[model samples]
Target: MISGILAYRNIQNSILNGVKIPHSTSQPLIFGENGKYYLAVFVFFFSREDIEKGLVERPTMWAVADIETGKIIEIRQTKNKEFSDASYKIKYNVRADAQYDTSKKYYEKAFAILDSCRNEIINTDRFNPEEYKHYLDMIVANIPKEYQRFYFDLSV
Candidate 1:
């Protein structure tokens, strides 16, 4: 059985590897439902100038992944309705303060988007329970002994 954290890390790494973008930030959110693990990795694109200005751009792309197999299920480049408006305008003496405020809003939006995606996946019957279990078993069999202790059994 793989620990939840380990699964999350693997899923995040897989998404990051699949989507390559320089000077971008990512936030990966994980959740399990009906014996299946799913992840939505949101990637925010920004340039050096944007960072200097303490701007937090909306997520340009996002990928959905199967945590059990550490594979991307889908990638979306379309903008969501929540972020259709222009970003918030704020000024601060400290760059970090401005970044914090903007980043907080971006993360909140990311969470909302993930929740929406999760609802869709759960309601649409997108996952197969048997297949999820098979992938879990495969992960357990392949994981090294040294790493086993760190990963709690998910089967419990």
Candidate 2:
């Protein structure tokens, strides 16, 4: 049961520090799937008025990382229910080769289905802490029951 602060720190640090990416501005929701790690980086890009009024923002990105191998294999981005291109890379720490099937499999599958998972959250006009959790819950719920575990809210 990797939840609360430990799960948050593990996923966030592994992705941000492991992949050499800049630390995320806000918290991210982390969960596991089939021994691989996945995170939803929720972003609010609308105006202050919209935010104050509990409007959901656009451009939420879902990141899939191989934590055991310390690599970010894929990322899917969305803006106003539309898919956007995102960069995905294998960290230098993980050698991308046949010898590492467990890690490579996660990356490969993540890449293959990146498009289908975009814009998973549809409520763009209502954003709140509760809604955020609901969105994460929805994302997690969509995952196959056997491949899911350790949902947590993490802050940078």
Candidate 3:
């Protein structure tokens, strides 16, 4: 039951082909199918206006799959729905993601953020740093060679 906070923009600004949250979920998680350790990541954001447009701003699930070890190291489940009985239903989806998956710069920039933003992450309720970092290493071990740039060591 580990949850993360990814700005509403990160996914929206992604460059991967058809890398939509719900759609691309299986690919990442499937990689863990052959691994030793499994990880599941769930990101949640709240927005009032996004509801009118039918968006998943509340919960974003990202499960990790290690192809060689047959393990699902992580899981992320997204849930975006109305708070029943609540009067306020209009919330803005996370403003936007600052980077795109298709670019190396994106990963580098993200790495910088991860290195400097540990405290911010905890304060933002976007992650449980201790848990996610350990799982991230397990997830990265399965990444293809070319994509390795997207994975980095963020030890603070």
Candidate 4:
């Protein structure tokens, strides 16, 4: 419960910090794995400097990993069109002006959780909805009945 909220709050911070959270507002990030429920929130993309410094470059996707089950799913794909200069400018404006209310501690905690679960996320260069759905179906089928309601809300 606590960690889930923390993750959401951290993503909210990213939005306020001039970065898109990368998911929709109509849903609560949801997953069931290893007998647990996880709510994911997308963090920001690496800056040009950070990219040049070898931290990260050319990030065009997002992820929400199930820490317990070691299943990390890329939540969305940002096509070149989706992030074109014009679109980026729009998102950037929103992010820059958005108010961030989460605390420092929340960001740290969310980072820790994501880092710990990093290994679970299988890397790929592109975002394919069909492929994501195959994985999503597999994971969804494995979730216990009690969590079905949550998944229903999260399904696109």
Best by lDDT: 1
Report the CA-based lDDT of candidate 4 relative to the real structure.
Answer: 0.38
lDDT of 2 at 82: 25
Worst 10 residues of 2 by lDDT: 87-96
List clashing residue pairs in candidate 1: none
**Whole-model lDDT for model 1 versus the true structure?**
0.45
What is the lDDT for 108 in model 4?
Answer: 53
lDDT values for all models: 0.45, 0.36, 0.33, 0.38
| Candidate 2 runs further than 4 Å off | 1-7, 10-42, 67-71, 79-156
Best by TM-score: 1
Q: Name the weakest run of 10 consecutive residues (lDDT summed) in model 3.
A: 26-35
**Tens-digit per-residue lDDT, 51-97, candidate 4:** 34433323244445453332444455556212212223322211222
- What residue runs in model 1 are displaced by over 4 Å at the alpha carbon? 16-20, 31-37, 79-95, 98-156
Q: lDDT-based ranking, best first? A: 1, 4, 2, 3
Per-residue lDDT of model 3, residues 1-156, tens digit only: 121123212332332234443322211211122222232222334344443454433223343433222234334432342212212344323223333243555444443433333334435534445554554444454444322322331111
Model 2, span 1-156: residue lDDT tens: 222233335545654445543233223443344443344443223454543553323335545543223244655454433233322221111112223233545533433233222222222321234534544454444332321222332211
